[model samples]
Target: MMTEQDTEILIVGGGVGGVSAALAALERGRRVVLTEETDWLGGQLTTQLVPSDEHIRVETTGRNASYARFRDLLRSHYRAFYPLTDEAAADPHLNPGAGWVSPVCVEPRVILSVIDGLLRPFVSAGQLTILLETRPVAVATSWDRIDAVTFETADGAEIVVSASVVLDATELGDLLELGGVEHVTGRESREQTGEPSAADTADLLDMQGVTWCFAIDHRDGEDHTIDRPARYEHFRDWRPSQLHGERILGFERAPEHAGDPARAYLLTPNPDDDPFGIDVDHRNMGGAPELWTYRRILARRQFQPGFFASDVTIVNWPMNDYIGGPLFGTPDAAEHRAAAKELSESLLYWLQTEAPRPDGGAGWPGLRLRPDIAGTADGFAKVPYYRESRRILAERTIVEQDFSVEILGDNAAVSYPDSVGVGHYFWIDRHPSTGGHPGGGGRPQPFEIPLGALIPRRVDNLLAAAKNIGTTQITNGSYRLQPVEWSVGEAAGAIASFAVAGATTPRAVRNDERLLAAFQEDLVAHGAQLRWDSALRW
Candidate 1:
C-alpha cells in the first residue's frame, strides 16, 4: 500500500529555503508534510557543505531575528562541543571558521543538527512529517490549483501529499516543472528587464554554474593524493575561453578586466595572507583574500593546542565552476552534471599536484580531502551547490531598478505594499553563463520581497519558496544567496499559514490589503523580518 498524507502545507525541497519554510509554517501552527531528496536537511548548509557566503552586514541589519538566533545557536554549538580557547569562547561574537567571507561559518553538521533540533519538536507533536531520501515523481494540478504532490521514496514506496498550499522550495525548483507552473530560466533580455547587467537578448538556457563543494585539510610533509579523475588530462590541459587565456586551474581575470589577470590563492602559499597582522577579519573580501578564505570551515588557531591538525578549508572557487552547461532542463543534463562533478575533482587534483606553493614551487601534495565532512568518500559534496533555479513566472519580476545599488545610489529600496520579508546581497555574480557573457557582476542595493512575487500568475495555491521566486536572470544572482533564500522560504511559509487560517487562496490574501497587512504582522510575530530601517534610505 502507498503512504498517503494530508497537511495544510506541503513544502518540497529541504534546502535552506525548504527548512526555513517548514519552520515558519510550524511556528504558525500549520501542519506540514516536508519532503527532502537528501537524507539531510539544510541543503546548502549541510548537503553542499559550503560555508556561509554572506554579506558584511550579517551581524546587524537586513537579517531576521530567527536567522540571528540560528547564528547564535551555531556559535553556542561550537562552545558546547568543541574545545575552544578562552578568548574564542568568551568573545561574544565567535565565528567558528574565522573565515573571511562571512561572520558565521561552521561545519555543515552543526547547521544540520540545529535544523533537526528545531524540526524534531514539530515532528514529535505530529504537526510536521518529514520524508527524507524522497524525490518527487509527479504533481497533480486541478485547474489552477495544486491538488496534490506525489513522491517516490528511496525504498520504492510511493507517497501522496494533499495540501492546502504547496511551496516549491526545491533546489532547482523541480516543482515548477512537475506542477506545470510557468517559469523563466537563463538570461533575460536587457530590454525586458531594463537591467543594465542583463544580456542584450534573452538566452533561455543560460544559467549560473553549479559547484560541487568539498572540504580539505593541510597536513605538512604528508602525501594525500586522490586517484586522478578519468577526465583529468582533459581538464588539466584545457583553458577557459571566458577568462581570456588563463588555464582553468590558473589565475584568471574577470571578462571586464583585460590586464594581467589576478592569481588564484592557495592554502600553503599564503599570498593573500597578511604576513604581520591577523589573516581573518570582517573586512570587505573583494580581492584575492575572498578566494583564499572563501570557504575555510575550521580555523585551527581558534581551538586549543593539539585539538586540530590543520585548518580545513572548502573548495568552492571559480576554478571548480562547471560552465560547460546548465544542470537541469536540458537534454544533456546528466552528462553536464557528471562533467561538473569531474571539474571539482580536477580542481582538487590541481590543488594537490599543480597549484603553486610558497616555496617557489608547484603543488601541495600534502593537501587532503575530508570525506567525513562532505558525506562522500570521494570528497565531493552529497549534492552540487546550485546557484540558480527555474524561477516562477512571477506576477511581479524584480528588475534592477528595484534593487541595484548602482542605480538606487543610496535611495531606499523600492517598497512593496505587500512586502513579506527583507534581504540584501550583490546583484549579479559569477554567472556560469553560456556565449561568453560577463563573469563578475554588479553590486546591488538591499531589497524588499513583495508578496506578488511569491504568487505565480496563474498558479492559485502554489508558492515559490526558494530561488524560484519572481526574479530576472540579472536579479537572480543576488536573490539566490543564503540569507535571501532563507527569507524567501520564511515568507512563503507565513503566507501559507495566513491563507489557511483565513480560509483564503494565496492570490486572494495577496490582493486584500487588510489581509496582506495582517499576514505581514504574523511574519513579524514569528521572527521574520519585514523591513530595513531609515539608514538604508537615501
Candidate 2:
C-alpha cells in the first residue's frame, strides 16, 4: 500500500544542500519533509568521509558570519568532546602555523553527530519529517508545476508527498531526471556558450566522473596485506601522463592550466627521522605509498605507538572516476559506474597488500575499510560525489562571460541584482577536455548567484539546490563546490518560503523587488551571506 504525506516543502537528498534547505524552510515556519537515500544525513560530511573541502577563506575568520557559524559548530564539537590544548583551540587558523587548506581536522562521525544535532530542533518541533533510506522515485507534475513527489523506501514501499515547493538536493540531480525536468546531462561544447576555451560543440555524455572515497589507518610493524584485487595488475600499470609519474595518486593541475601546473609529490616512509620539510626526488612510490603518506601527514601523531599513522583518503586513484577514452563514450552508464567501483576496490586491495610502509615493509594487510568512520555500510561515500547533473534549462542561464577572469579581471566581480548567496571555490575539477575545449586549467573568477539560476523557466513549484541548478557547462565548473552548494540550497529554501507565504510562484519572487528584498532580509536573518561589502572582504 502506498502512503501519502503533505508538507509545505519537499527536500530531496538529505545532503548539505537538502539539510540546509530544510533548516531554512523550517525557520520560515514552513513544514518540510526531507528525504535521504541513506540512513544518515550530512551528505559530504558524514557519508563521503570528506573533511569539508571549504575554500581557505570560508573559515572562522572569513568574511561571512554564516560560514563562521559552521566553523564554530565544528570547533564546538571538538571542544565539547575531545579535550584540546588551549594552544590548539586559540589558534586563529584552527591549526595555528600549519598551512593546510581547511582549518580543522575532524572525524567523520563527529560531523554526522553535529549535523544530526542541528536538525533535531526541527524534527522535535514537528515542522520537519526526516525520512532516511527514502528516495524520490517519481515526481507528479502538471504542465508547469510539481504536484507531489513519490518516494520509495528500502522495503519498496512508496509514499507520495505533496508540497508547495520541491527542492532537488540529490547528489546526482536524480529528481531532475525523474520529473522530466528540462536539464543538460553532460558537457556543453565551447561554441554553445562562447566560453573562450569551450570544446567546439556540446557533448552531453562527457560528464566529470565520480569518486568513491575511503579512509585508511596504519599500524606499525604489522603486515596488513589483505589481498590483491582481481583487477589489481591492470591498475598497477595504469598511469596517466597527467600524474607526472607511474603513480595515479599524485597531483595535477586543473585541466585548463595544463602547462606548468603546480606539482604535488607522493609521500614515502621516513623511518629514521621526520621528513616533514624535506623535498626529495624519485618520491613517487608508484601510487600506493603516496596515497598513504598524504593521509599520514594530516595527523602523524594520531597513529601513536605505530611509527606513523594517517587518516589517508584516496580521492583520485584509479578505483573510482570512470571517465576518459572509451569509458567516456560508453552507452551503458551503469556498467561504467560498476567498473569504477571495481577499480576503486582494486586500488584498496593493492593498498592493503602491496603498499609500502614507513618501516620499509610492503603491504599493510591490516588496512581496514572503516564504514563506521565514513558513517555508511559500504565503506565508501554514502553517495557518489557527482560533479555534474541534469541542469535545468533555466530562463536566465548564467554563462562564463558573467564571471571570466579575462573579462572581469581586476574589476568588481559580477554581482547579480537578485543575488541569493556567496561562494568561492576553484572551477570544475577532474573532467577531461572534450569537444575541442582548451586543455588547460586556471583560477576561476569569483561569481554570484542570480535568482534566475534557482528559478526554473516554467516549473512553478520546483527549484534546484545544488549542481542541478540551471548553468551552462563552463559555468557549472565554477559553481559546483561545498560552499556554493550550500548557497544554492539556502536560496532555494528562502525562495520556497517566500512563495508559500505570498501565495505566488518563483517567477513572482524574482519579478517583485519588494518581495525579493523581504526574502533577502529573511536570508540575512538566518545567517546567510548574500551580498558583498568591501569592508567584509576576506
Q: Residues 1-538, candidate 1, lDDT per residue (tens digit)?
A: 5978898999999998899889988988999999999989998888988777676666877887888888899999999999998888997878767776677778988898899888999999989999999999899988999899999999899999999999999998899998889998888888888878777788877877788888888777999988889999888777666656667776544434556446554454222343123333433344454454567778777889688877777888878877788888889999999999998888888888887666778888778888888777777799998888898998888887887777878787788888877887644554657556646666666678888888999988999998899998777777888888888999888889888998898789888888877888888887777777857632
All candidates: TM-score: 0.95, 0.85
RMSD for each model, in Å, please?
A: 2.2, 4.8
Worst 10 residues of 2 by lDDT: 278-287
Model 1 residue 205 CA deviation in Å: 1.3
lDDT string, candidate 2, 420-495, tens digits = 8776554434354223232223444556688798777778888998778888766777677666777788788888
Q: In TM-score terms, which candidate is top?
A: 1
